[model samples]
Target: MPFTPFHMGAGLAAKAAIDRHFSVLTFGIAQIAMDIEPLIGMIRDADVLHGPTHTYIGALAIGFAVILVSPFICRPILRRYNYEARAMRASWLACPEHLSKGAVALGAFIGTLSHVLLDSLMHADVRPFWPVSNSNPLLGLVSVDAVYQLCFWLGAASAIAWLVGKYRHGRENG
Candidate 1:
């Protein structure tokens, strides 16, 4: 799957919303990219799939699935982070009262969904409205090229560095 800054951005945003569910967001983007690029390749003779997965349904389904399983997969991490054991259990059970439950679910869903929508906006001919219509709309300014990839890597690195710096500053001040 092509690594686009669109998806990377979504993943980063997801981290803020879900408190570290970027993996699910990025993974969902990759998954959707893999599924769509091949089909897009077949139709456009480009040798990749980049169509259906960019649709709204794809985003919803994948996002829902990822969010649904997040608590289970991240249980240990949550515990490590000092989440109450009972709260964690309730989140795992999808209880509304769990402190971070909604945030976690929304984070995963939004992050994954954002990747799909963001990719849709960037491509020249994405079936984002697929099963509904097939109009090629261009909503992005950057082309999926090496330059864009560089920007993504640099942005992610910068965000990481800034976060690390802030953490260290806080520690030192404390």
Candidate 2:
């Protein structure tokens, strides 16, 4: 909600829990995709910061775009990542291989959709159901601090899960 990094907590949790079914990398890209509208609106001094891009329709479009693009980007990156982690004796840091198409789609959709829902909680201008209802009933349903805590706790839990997994697999570095 504050920035893309804030979204990583949920992404990491999803990746840790779902394993091969989710990709935090693709989710990060999708967060960027969802935020592009707000970034531009802020830059141009537009009245509506979280406009169309913070809607289900907009998220679907962003997800599709990410699905189409992530493979090309994530594959090469993961190849190098796998190699480097192995070299560093931290094989758990590596993904088995590049995420599958389904995983990419899952991550993209989850990232974009969750971004809208989370922002809707704190931002008044975010009409998550825009063009249909143009109302953000979910707005302020939860406090901003609560959302931040949720993110922090989810990230911590994911990190703990990852560490437990790494050591269980006997691949933890040091």
Candidate 3:
């Protein structure tokens, strides 16, 4: 994935489908963390754009790091979003000011792990197994266009599901 935003489609869908268990905020942070290596490489013109950070082991380490640091980041953002939601009269759009440790861990792992898997499909240098195996058996399995389309449709589905869920919840409350 060229951008973390593309990965966010999955996070949005997961958050929608499993509202209690998934934290899209934490997921987004993990996605950004996964991409940091590539971004830096691209900036510095490094020979290997996808280095060890694109590997499963590295991603897991990053996931744990993100999990540890997410609370400090998630808190203020959640508070601001919830505040804006209240002012806009869209309380349903508001989220808890604090994400449970479980949600943060779940989102971090899902985000980082899935990022590596997805990148493996498109980038030849993406060695998910890394130290265990340098060969990317998953590369070229799908076209880059297909991956983009998948993300786009997932985002569309997430939006539709959210709207429908909101409507249903409003009716139930009424």
Candidate 4:
């Protein structure tokens, strides 16, 4: 549970404006995305890989993967802003602001990796140091029970709400 919201919220915060509703939503989704496999397998299989989302390599790969796809996601919204690219690369653009493709890729990588780190701390048996060597520390710090779940949900909700309110306020004022 901790990993689900934390990872996703980090994703949202990284991709969108820091205080945007969509960022929170995206974070929540990313955090919970891997849970479904385990939940379903718990009833059917005794031993499952818990899916790739739990792995550090998997998280980084997924994050950058999402960023690579972001151009498609931004295309429609960007159209109104008259967004243009200096090159044909989807990852690079020559827009109103001065930015680099590396920045976007880095943001996507960090956003996703944050989720893996947060989740590994809470969930036991997670192989964070995977591929590089599945060596990890037994940092048994937190539990993923009702209270913790509620807190994570609340944090996500609050961040999302704040972002929405800010967006609305900005629209009204602008």
| Candidate 2, residue 140: lDDT | 82
TM-score of each: 0.56, 0.92, 0.94, 0.52
Across residues 47-161, which tens digit of lDDT does each residue of candidate 1 receive? Answer: 3356566677776776676666665655555455444634555223121223365666565566555655555655665677778777646455456564357547754865575
Give lDDT tens digits, candidate 4, residues 1-174: 433334444454444453322332223334454455457667686474355666877777676566556545444544544344323432222222322455555555565566567666666657777767665573455555643564556557665765565556656655
Q: Ten consecutive residues with minimal summed lDDT in candidate 2?
A: 165-174
lDDT per model vs. reference? 0.53, 0.85, 0.86, 0.52
Candidate 1, clashing residue pairs? 36-49, 36-50, 37-48, 37-49, 37-50, 38-48, 38-49, 39-49
lDDT of 4 at 76: 55
How would you order the candidates by lDDT, starting with the best? 3, 2, 1, 4
In model 4, which runs have C-alpha deviations exceeding 4 angstroms? 2-46, 51-53, 74-107, 146-161, 164-172
> What is the number of backbone collisions in each predicted candidate, taken in the order shown?
8, 0, 0, 4
- lDDT winner between candidates 3 and 4: 3
Question: Which stretches in model 1 have alpha-carbon errors above 4 Å?
Answer: 1-6, 14-48, 77-99, 121-125, 139-141, 146-154, 161-174
